[model samples]
Target: MSAPEPVVVVGAGPVGLSAALAAHALGLRPLLLEARTRTAERPGSRAVFVHRATLDRLDAVRPGLGTEIAARGLVWDTRRTLWAGRQVHLRTYPADPATAPFTSLPQTVVEDLLRRACDEAGVRTLWGDPVREAVPSSEGVRLRTASGAVHGARHVIAADGARSAVREAVGIGLDGSTSATEFVVVDVADGERPARPERVFHYRHPAAGGRHVLLVPFQGGWRVDVQCRPGDDARHLAATAREWLPAVLPQVPGPEVTWSSVYRFQLRVAARFADATGRVLLTGEAAHLLPPFGARGMNSGVGDAVAAARAVRDDAVEAYARERRTAAERNVRAAGAALDHLLAPRPGLRLLQRSAAVAAPLWPRAGRWLDAAPYGPRIRKVRY
Candidate 1:
């Protein structure tokens, strides 16, 4: 028998796992190398939204996978913005039964599901085996792991995330700047349920100089994300939490904190999706990163994985680079715009926010446009 078709995937995060799954579905035996020993077990919540387009893609690869995830996750249909004591409910688009609905699930749960799917598909997974170096040649790419074992593959996919070692080794520069705003994410047990279970809760402190806090109900609790302004001490995360929640979420009693993390927002995109050698390709955070404002980061990466896998299967790597690069750039732009609009400091911005709130009910079309436009790209199934 001939040697097995070689494809190596670095990183086993959701994006990495999805890429591996996509490759496996396309009849390629992929070797997935992950630095971490296992999937995350903690309660930290990140990237909770998955779009309808992604669900369709997942369904096509492994039937009922999207439905399985949805059964375990929550469907968030409405978005609201809060200012002082006032709440503005935004308009929502009707769900299309033909396409899957947009759903919110914890990152850990999604990764776990993908891991199980990979196992069932017989994809080779190497844990704690960090790729030390990746060298490309005329024939194929050679990877040396930390344990000194060398492996060769016809193609290498770098899904290792923002601090991608594969991108560094191949010398691809990321283009973008980190934002000034920092966010603190705190997860706590659900002390009480909200009156409205299906809507995302947003609270802006008018007296606190426009500081905003968002309470997203997930699993058995809520994920609290607070925007921190300049000159704020990172150590004051807990104090900020206590001060903000009582005013924002009056219904839920104070919760026992579970996990908290501070992240600085950054928007970046790879200068090139493929390395100079053309044997190595970048996907997920390896290719792009967006501010977490609109949940476009993971959605964009998953789309990249799907497109890249299909391109490789059809021997259209160049087309993969072009398509993914365009998509990444579009997401970066949308994420930046959303962040700017949400975090605006001027009186004009306050006016805009207030206007958006007041007009949402009168002109529901405009409200739906603003609320769904940023995330709309993720739902579009682009042909590679």
Candidate 2:
């Protein structure tokens, strides 16, 4: 038998790790490449919420993987939305007890768990080596590292994130819009009073001049997101978060910020997930970007990686593009609605939002229409 063509995966993030694991499950050896010496050491949780569909996809790659993740992550079915200190909407996702509706795990932990899985599957990772040049040829994709070392692969999975060097080398482009409102995330710990373990969203805070604050519970602390005016400074964000975080997470007393991050989020997707030869592929933030409102960013990317690997193995990479594109469109729409609801500067929109929030609490039956960002419609599985 001829030597098996190598399958190379770029980036060691969750998407990259998942891609490698998926390929290994399909009887293919995968080489993972990462520019960084190690995973990010950021203090706050980057992406936490993992949806049911994502868990299902992960289980497909490795049997019982979803159960293990669910055991480590936070699983919830109810989220409460408050406007002006009044509980407006108490949305609940009633699902079968066997399958949790949603789960939340820190991005770093997720990556670490995936890396362990890769190790068990005998996948090799080259740390501190970034793929510099990617030349797509009929035979395969020829890649050159930043150190000038050359490697050849039958195909490539680009999971290098939004600032993907591999995507640039292969000339793949993404399109999306950035919201006008800026979001600052801060993870804080309060030993005196622990934060409530629930998804709490405060919209139209009186002290913040109707701005929004989102609070999600993590393992040891609460990850707080403060909506700020465009181009706000860090000092302003810090002070604002310190003053108003309690409005959303009232139980926390004397909160101490451990790590904070400021970023401009967008909703973007690549023109295509795969090249014409199906040799070059994109996954995770490399393929698309969506705000964290519905926990769509990293969660959706995991799905992309799993589907891409299966498609690549089955010689039907186009199916990955078609199925993922549909999901991206749906997620983009959900993100837009969430962003608008978060920052309803317009009088008419603000009134509509307030009415919906009230409707949810008053008539729980009306919540189906008041969902700011529902956990998306069911995505059809791509049969590769």
lDDT of each: 0.73, 0.75
The predictions' CA RMSDs to the true structure, in order, are: 3.5, 3.4
TM-score of each: 0.87, 0.88
Q: Write the per-residue lDDT of candidate 1 for residues 1-384, one digit (tens) a residue.
A: 134236788999888888898999888888899977874354576777777777777877778887777677665555665555465555455444344356666788888888899899899998987888988775678888898878888888889989999999989989998877778787766675544434443435564445667667665666777777788775586556666666555546775677777887788989999876677889989998887644677777877887777776787778888888998877776666666666765798667666776777677654553353223323343321
Expressed as tens digits, the lDDT of each residue in 1-384 for candidate 2 is: 233356889988888988898888898788888988875454667887766777777788887777677778765556777667777667667534357766776877777778888887789888988888888776788888988877788888889989988889878889988776677788877456654567777766676666677777765677787777755674577656667666545678777777777766698988888876778888889988888755677888887888878887897778878888877777777776666655666899767666777777668654544445333323344211
Candidate closest to the true structure, highest TM-score: 2
- The per-residue C-alpha lDDT of model 1 at residue 165 equals 90
Off by over 4 Å in 1: 1-5, 39-43, 90-100, 192-195, 200-203, 206-209, 238-244, 345-347, 354-384
> By how many angstroms RMSD does model 1 differ from the true structure?
3.5
Candidate 2's TM-score reads 0.88
Judge candidate 2 at residue 200 and give its lDDT.
Answer: 73
Please name the candidate that would achieve the greatest lDDT relative to the true structure: 2
